[model samples]
Target: MAKGERPKDSRRLSRKKTKQKIFFDEVCRMTKLVPKNKLTTYGAIARAMGVDNYSRHVGFALGKVKASDGVPWWRVINSSGRISFRPKDRVGEGTRAKPFTSLQSIKLAGEGHTFTEAGAIVGWTKKLHDFNR
Candidate 1:
């Protein structure tokens, strides 16, 4: 955090790890809603756990869980609340990018989350209080 020190990447990496650890338990609790109800998004988990700016960090934690831990990692999505698949491109074609949005979407869908036509959640955080409340 020094002057003219472009340590943004390092700072982000460290914060990502720390946020992942802090939000891990909350993410697990949210994922437990799956197989009975629908999937919960990373944003939901982060908000529930009081993490204002580390929503995607929750996704990283879930990915780590999928790789090694046994946490229920298939219950997260984007802010839009949709489960969109990664755009597929045939051989010798362009657009082979695999955005994490699709992965988050697929995992949430696997847990039975219902999406609207525009991909928003059916009934997301309706009862939650607003900032002024």
Candidate 2:
């Protein structure tokens, strides 16, 4: 499919599912470009895909990626440069459970991304990968 064009199956599926797949695919592709130790926000990925208001959709897409997908899902974060996943215990009923935030933080730290004492990414604006530029 052409970039920015919806998939052929879009017409047959529910609107939400179709958009989710498109946003998911775009996020997966763009995430592969983020270099180690650098990061981008869910909002940044959404903007890159030309969906400025779909930042949460970017998060949804990342949640669906499997380890075998090789999408570097860990490189994406919330706009505040914080890990977006809540602890499993804090998740409400019917919500998707997430792996521990500490695990995500550890992985980012291993890649050389620094964090503040309170756990937000340190100097996040400076560390963001500006794909648009």
Candidate 3:
């Protein structure tokens, strides 16, 4: 308990928050790389960030960004090519019973993409944008 010393738990929490902020920033940077008519998955971004299991973390970070940030958050989706929405944990907005906001869908469509009734992107495999390439 020196004047400049932090508690062990406090130190760890500080480091964790720093790492989370760095990860969130990286996620936004990568999301910006996706072009129109293309898409990337959560796991794909996690992999690019050098973490194999950060898919949820990727989604969580994007959920925190406001649309005015112009980071193209809608360009990222699930690994299976389906749009995630509602359930709060899914797309960062809406409830489990409420339909997801059309903002994402509308933005995506304006970029020349289509979705099935089930919210799965049509011909998604071809639209997959690979960062490694």
- Give the winner by lDDT: 3
- TM-score, model 2 to reference: 0.74
| Per-residue lDDT of candidate 2, residues 5-121 (tens digit) | 988877778777776677678889999989888899988888888889988878877888887999888788898878887343133334245423455676788988888866689
Evaluation by TM-score, superior candidate among 1 and 2: 2
Q: How do the residues 39-85 of candidate 3 rate in per-residue lDDT, one tens digit apiece?
A: 99999999988999989989889889876878988888898897776
**Stretch of 10 with least lDDT, candidate 2:** 86-95
TM-score of each: 0.46, 0.74, 0.80
What lDDT would each prediction earn against the true structure? 0.56, 0.79, 0.84
Model 3, residue 40: displacement in angstroms?
0.6
After the best TM-score superposition of candidate 1, give how far the Cα of residue 84 lies from its true spot, in angstroms.
Answer: 7.1
Residue pairs with colliding backbones in model 2 are none
Q: List residue ranges in candidate 3 displaced over 4 A.
A: 1-8, 86-101
Assess the local accuracy of residue 54 in candidate 1 as a C-alpha lDDT between 0 and 100. Answer: 74
Model 1 poorest ten-residue lDDT run: 84-93
